[model samples]
Target: MNLDELAKKQSGSIPGYELVDYYEAAFPVYRVIVIVAILTEQNLPVVQEYILKMLDCGLNNIGDIGGFLGLSNEIIEDSLVPLTQQELVLSYLEGNSLKFSITEKGKDVMESLKVKKPTITSLPIVFDALTGSLEPHKTGLAKAKEVKDLEIPIIKPYLNKPMLEDIEFNDVRKLIKRMQKENTDIAPPPGELLDIIEVEKAWLEYKRLKVFVFYSAKEDDVMVQVFERTQRAPEYETRLLRMEREGIRVLRTVKKQSVRNGLLVENLSFNNEDLKSNEESIQEAEERVKILTKNLAEAEEEKTDQTSIHTIKRQLEEARRQLEIFQKGDRVLSTYEHRPILEQALKNAQNRVLIISPWIERGGMDDDLLALIRAALTRKVEIHIGYGISDERSSNDTYPVKKLKEYLSKSFGKYLKLHKLGNTHEKVLVCDEKFAVVTSFNWLSFKGDPNRGFRRETGLYTQNPVTIKNIIEDTLKRFNEASC
Candidate 1:
């Protein structure tokens, strides 16, 4: 039962090792694999190696643990300190060399998790008053592969039950495939994956409406809500809006139903406005489906005799490559609509962040932006800021810019560089020379204000290394020329 005995037993499992950790009880097997690989597989002494592994497992960074883990990164990160203190994990610096290694005690902690058993408990059953039905609410399951980065429900602390039935596996696989095809970034809820098969008919009635339901699992409550189509009140607006469009009236939930396994069901009713949209969407879908079905049938008949398996395989491979490229390079951002695109790019910047904005001032710098910069700095990301001085602008209007520069110099010291240019007006952001955003939007001044009739800004975001390299070279050249 102790850590030592558990580690010994787990070590016997060898390449097929199992991980057990009380603290990491809620984590899925894949995540545990990440930890196990770091502790046992990665021989590199540098903490950077372990960090890279986390990134490979879909974590943006050590700070972005919550983005993947569905838990606080700070908690996991802080736990490492105590791990070292207890001699469960060793940390040392040899002449500016940083290294991390799991001690024998650490292996014991992992071993214990492998042997741990889950506690069985009864799930809360929903009580439907209107139907007077006492049917047990069935939980939905997603294939583990589909929700690889999603936080899956743990049957009990440190215990996870595997999917058993072949029918269920095939069903979940199809659902996951559909989800991946439709939305790559969206994951299913903890307990149940939404069965779109049953909803497709109803969904087609409003297929034209851009609607999405994102769900999350709290301690004892499963929160499910639809994405906002209309821009809410001023106070409700986020720092970034993914879609810049006017709102339309939607189907509203009328009566709340009881919860089962933390899943809350509700009765929804559509108003006249919603019904009108639904009718339009249904007609469009019918016409579109008819055309698509006809085209598909013709294509299939033509290909049936002519198409070779090898040729089909090659076509699929090519299609996958194109999809990957499109997904990476297709992110076009408008500062007039979405500024968070740039903000997120900055937050995810690991090695460097290069900004070329003609004007930079403290007035436009919000707390969120400041925090992002500071976080990047903490990760040792180089910050290069290029700005211009305008002849039309007053010399006395330099306080905000001056304060910003002073703060950067004082805070980040050697990692920060501020370049003053002569009337430069280009705005671009390049991160690690791997991702770049070139925009007409002022990175320093513009925050999407609906009331402000500012110039509608447009920007292109690309992950193409060649494109990023060209932009970086050109921007650096301009910065150098402006200095002269």
Candidate 2:
């Protein structure tokens, strides 16, 4: 499974958090050369074994031994130096002829070499970057060049510069025992760990892993979960947290700085246009209200028929209501304000409500929100919804949408329209011509869970007639486009 699937699995455990986003990140993997002593067998060379056996059989002369072993006398003399120095062989002059003999030590050595023998030998071992555990040397680790080419962020270890002195004998011993128990082919035979003679710190490598960042607004905390090979790596998460606490900026910092400035400018330009249109609409609606009020006053002064006066009063009230709808200045809503505004709109809508959000999941469309929808549908309020950010609808949770269709289609299908758009980033909610909200908040995918950590989401809540009309028209256009 991919990071998305892994994030979903992780979501259930995070009580009040939602999976906002995930990204590719890396952990430092270092290649360390550790000189370790292990218990292993050392075998005698074939030629040496033959010479020793020959000497034991009373072949004292080099010529006789070499002849039997199918080697020249010169070769026999060269091989004899080590044996002699090791005290396994003795050289003597017998009747002016050089001869060789196997010592008692040589007999013991020969016998011991035949069976598995424990020997102290230095070997290079690798240290795990995440757990700081010892492991066999591995190849195919991602190099700095490969990691640089990737667009992901890299989480540098708190101890950036690792030294060989950090490796200890006990760590190596435990690793060897574990490997032996597991019957790993690469592990040395079971034996005691000798002193760690030397450690050579090699170049740092990187292992790409997935990271899911969760925000808890209530606690004002950020929780990070890391994954390697589709499994949670809590040790790595701890490392990241430690780095951050040590004044080292990590994933969150990188993500913040990576936002493109050009996109911000484009969004600002669009918002400015909406603001200008709202101002013009407000001015015109104010003028219309003034004219209606003046007409109602003139009719009262003329003492018109009771029916005509009553009609004028009703018209004047409608004009004032329309003016009020446009005069309530637009507002900037925070993450906390989105829910109540959306719910209020749903509850108070008289004619229609239009919502456009990219995703629909249980997190946003909980039982409460679903009930509100049901009430709106029961009132015969026209509800149009547009969702989906990918070409395939399967990318989203289909079960919720399916259930909605199955439950409401029979009775309210005519009034409820669910349009799966090919792709959209727009988060909008419009209630008839009364008010509308346009923001970064995902209205259908996030329900402003109080237990969730803070996410910096803001929306423009507007009662301006022109802005509301534009949003509603644009939303319905998208719905029509998607249906095509």
Candidate 3:
């Protein structure tokens, strides 16, 4: 069906809607109601409003279509554009504005997504493989007036299939209650069955249109996006050696898995290394969980009932711990978000700018991020970029200080005093003491479409003094202190 006819027939999610999109096709395989709950019902109207008013894409310029639909101008460069890189959409420059329209595949996705106007009963919880994660669901059911203990149901995307009857929703509800109350503790399920039950329970509530299924592996994606163009060689042993300390492989891998597969290019050959590092991270996160659990246990022993403070603190601790793991490093990390909502995060930082990228160049970066950097420079943000040049082992075509020096001079201008430090391999950007964006992105990955610059790369952004000091001081230590 044509776009206009589909619109007419669908009538734009009219009242009393219970519609769903059962994607029998590829990309965004979601049940209709679930789609509405996850990506659309809540934010679609906002997007519609923006398109109707702000954007003016016509017969002339239609640069990146998915971006136009998926993001506002502010986050288009960081989030939406990265999606385009992953072939999720298409985006390019047009005059002063970024005029975008969806690709045929994206359009097919739009058609495939089941949309409906769900009741204001529940919100979505998407378990991203990459960016962010989920906290166990707490409906305030026990906190609320219990109504016959409506067995906490587990929902699934396979909407019509008969659910297996063995798992009891009652036990699951009790488990959620313990998790929520910390009678037990926060954890991944012990086995595949528990995991399935977890999914099932999540799905049941989800079916009531409670959540979404935008499966995101942003962690791995974030790693892949940032590390692709990183210069890895046999010599200048620091960059290569640090991987062992961090339990990551030094070399990058670049290959496509199969014949039908469109070139799967993985440059960071440190797969085993990364896996070990990631496992260590997970274990550390769990350790923190144990600490919090201990605290909760002590609190429970002291009191007859758990208070709101404990609950909030428990949630906050877990979320914060996860954020730390998330902060480890990734390709497309942002200082803050500015999409579907407007934020002036970068506004007040016109005084002193500090940027440190390990490799410093690659992505389809001739776009918005560069625009911001230039704007900062024009406003005399006093840019001080510190890059760590890895000791060259191979003498290959790797761009060392000379290449980086040339790129900085060529792209950022002669006045751009980009400082080159030795011995560090972290990606960070601290903007004018006002904002700090700590990431895993080197200079090349930041601008590389091959890095998924626009999609959903995860990083930590903060104005909080605690977060700021931790990132900046640690990075500075890596810079000033000498280590081989």
User: TM-score of model 3 relative to the true fold?
Assistant: 0.27
| Cα lDDT of model 2 by residue, 96-180, tens digit | 9888889998998788754233455545566556567666666656887776544246666545444656776677787778777
Q: Candidate 2: RMSD over Cα atoms?
A: 20.8
Best of the candidates, TM-score: 2
Task: Encode model 3's per-residue lDDT on 1-484: one tens digit a residue.
Answer: 3212232233223333211111010111121111111112222333433332223333223334335566544543444443355343565676776545456554443444422232321212322111112234333222111211222222112222223342244443344444545543332222111222222322222211121111123332211111111232122223223442465432222121111111111111224455456646655675666676676667666773657546847675876669565544322222112110011322346566556654443221223445555666566555556654466521113333334345455544543565556534444566545556544334323221221212322333445555565556655554455431
TM-score of 1: 0.33
Query: Which scores better on lDDT, 1 or 3?
Result: 1
Show model 2 residue runs off by greater than 4 Å.
14-21, 32-43, 58-77, 81-131, 135-141, 169-201, 215-219, 253-484
41-145: candidate 1 lDDT, tens digit per residue = 222233423433443354433346445555476755665564566555566665765455665655655444321112222222212111111212223323344
Decreasing TM-score order of the candidates? 2, 1, 3
Q: Worst ten-residue run, lDDT, model 3?
A: 20-29
Model 3: how far is 121 from its true place, Å?
A: 65
| Segments in model 1 whose C-alpha atoms lie over 4 Å from true places | 1-325, 336-338, 394-400, 408-411, 447-454
- Quick one: how many clashes does candidate 2 have? 5
List runs of model 3 lying over 4 Å from the truth: 1-348, 392-415, 443-457, 474-484
